[model samples]
Target: MADNASGDTAGDALPRERKPSNTALAKQRAHIENLMQNVDKPIELPQPGSKKPLLKPPPEIVLNVRGSSAGAGSSDFHTYRELRRKEHLRIKLMEAEAAEDAIGEEFNREREALKRQDEEKTAKNRAKRQKRNKAKQSAKKSKPAEKAALPVADE
Candidate 1:
């Protein structure tokens, strides 16, 4: 059993009644709908730019000097020095190439000497084999003579 505010007990088998007020319920529902209407939607993101925006000024050529060696040097003088350095490098490269050629000739001579030694070794081996073969043949021929000189004996 459940008790109402008046101290009267309601039957457990019976459902409790809540009086419905149409005006009040409708106003509450409208207030909720108004709150829903005021809710914020998600914001859209900005699109990517097609071209990059300029951020800083373009680079400029600036001459920096630290010591007395770097004095009022003109652009023409700089270019001339570069050309002279290149010419010197070319001369050094030619000298290096000549040295390389000389080394290559030395290697070629050594290779030829090794080839000649190999050929001589092979010829010596061939001659040794031929001599061994001749000695074997002579031994074979002497076997018949030894057999003929043996005395006959009864078994």
Candidate 2:
């Protein structure tokens, strides 16, 4: 019986006999009343959105200027100097690498040019050898024909 009484009293938290707050407060209190009524059995959510929307994000506030610490103190100066030193070293290393790459590229280009020249020279020499062989073959054929054409001397 006590449990049933508590269950009956659980939903009657707001007194209907008394008047409620006005404006947004009344709407919020009404929503709370609706929520309390459906503690176990939900019926419907508050219509037309919440009275005071709680899901809104807070405003953004900038806490510090960009690189403000760069000119702040001795520690900042040391950090700035160290960063600049590293940047300079990085640039120097990049320039050295670029120069090395250029040198290597030129070396490869020269080597390829030399190879092409050698190949062309070999090709020309091979063509000359072929021509010489063909001429020798033709001369040998003429010599045999000329001997056959001449009168054969007494054997």
Candidate 3:
């Protein structure tokens, strides 16, 4: 009993399961440390007077929309504004199509609901008409019998 109690205590003191260490996390930490060390060095730059300009001046820009020879030889370049305008128009077209589809679906649903309501109303009206006709026929049959009995009594 003492040995069993001691074994139980030992088992309780130790963890029931052990989790494995993640190697990916260690590799990521090492990479981050290496990047930090590499970026910690000071950078050297040339003096303003010691360095020369690397680029030349840009050429003048001229736009001709009348099929003139001024811009005839230049390569056609699509500007950012033109691209944005095209994208805007495409987005508008898509929005319009989506709106049209949604409206069409709503209209179809409403039409079906109205048709069902109309059918229900017509069924009720038919029932009322049949009841009225039956009442009128019973009244007509009773009146004819009463009239025949009165004539026989007079004779």
- CA lDDT for candidate 1: 0.76
Better of 1 and 3 by lDDT: 1
Better of 2 and 3 by lDDT: 2
Q: Please name the candidate that would achieve the greatest lDDT relative to the true structure.
A: 2
Q: 48-91 in candidate 2: lDDT tens per residue?
A: 86543233232267343458446576566776686677667666
Q: Score candidate 3 by lDDT.
A: 0.73
| Residue-wise C-alpha lDDT for candidate 1, range 1-155, written one tens digit per residue | 34566566557557779865579888899877877897885445799885523333322653543466665656757866766776676667668778889999999999999999999999999999999999999999999989999988989
Q: How badly does each model clash, as a count of residue pairs?
A: 0, 0, 0
Off by over 4 Å in 1: 1-76, 149-155
Cα lDDT of candidate 2 equals 0.77
TM-score of each: 0.43, 0.52, 0.39
lDDT of 3 by residue, 86-119 (tens): 6676667668778989999999999999999999
Ranking by TM-score: 2, 1, 3
Span of 10 residues, lowest total lDDT, candidate 3: 50-59
